[model samples]
Target: MAQPHDAPTAAELVAAVREFLERDVLGSLEGRTRFHGLVAVNVLGMVERELDLGAAQDQAHAARLAELGFADDAELAAAIREGWLDGRYEELKSALLDATRDKLAVANPSYRS
Candidate 1:
């Protein structure tokens, strides 16, 4: 029950998550404990992956967009870059949902990516 003002450091957060999963989720499970363990491991893996490459991913995406002649005013550039950094994942998620809906209308519709 740590407040926002008591924000944990990265290591502390990882440890806390591990402890919670072990004590609350996995500890109570019997037959499905292995599945829960796998889920926990996958979650930790995803967190580690993001921590390792999040900045580099943003920089690479921005550089590619710049190379593609996406120049704009300073304010526009800042806005676009911020969206590219933070919103790309959400945008892609929405687009995927839309594509699935479109597929229901027509079989095997072409997807951009």
Candidate 2:
């Protein structure tokens, strides 16, 4: 009997991370350092989480845009999708913040008080 190929174990992931840290991060360092190993492990975990949720995040954004009438036109929908895929996170966040501020200004003219 053999284990299923689709089911990957935690130990296997840990071993792969260890090997990556040793070969890529640690090996690139000029001297023996623990910081690079720790950083590599942390980054690897972050990347794994992002990979797992990236599609769901995009879908959620697309759905929200459609609900908000942002996707009313095919050209607009395509532009929105392109902007999302090409835009930086910080740029998107800042744009959202500005839009919120503008909405608040229109809704509450006395907000300055």
Candidate 3:
């Protein structure tokens, strides 16, 4: 699905490293080393998902924040802290839920499932 280029794309390279850890590295480890390898695998999975979805997620997040009359996250947070959104609790809850779901879709899709 990628444009014409070499065989190994950046995502593929990351997947390779992740697989190596999942197989070879984890096999020879125990205790903290194994735990670290597991953590590394989780980190790599997040990285791969970010590589696939970070751009679109960024655009959606910014647009949603703008829709609430804020420029960005910091502005939105400031407004919330100042009790500006108190009258829009339902809207705020919906927006927050959508944002959290989007984040989980990247960080841990299975959890969403």
Candidate with top lDDT is: 3
**Which candidate would rank higher by lDDT, 1 or 3?**
3
Q: Best to worst by lDDT, what's the order?
A: 3, 2, 1
Candidate 2 lDDT by residue in tens digits, 1-113: 13654546544575588677867767566543677676666666555544454466556556645544465346544765777435455644554555445444434435533
| Model 3, global lDDT | 0.88
What is the Cα-based lDDT of residue 8 in candidate 3? 88
Each prediction's TM-score versus the true structure: 0.39, 0.36, 0.88
lDDT of 3 by residue, 61-86 (tens): 88888778888889889999999999
Point to the candidate with the largest TM-score: 3
Candidate number with the higher TM-score (1 or 2): 1
- Span of ten consecutive residues with least summed lDDT in model 3: 1-10
Tens-place lDDT per residue, model 1, 28-80, is: 66667768685875576456445555566556545544643454335435755
Q: Model 2: clashing residue pairs?
A: none
lDDT of each: 0.54, 0.55, 0.88
Off by over 4 Å in 1: 1-8, 15-30, 70-113
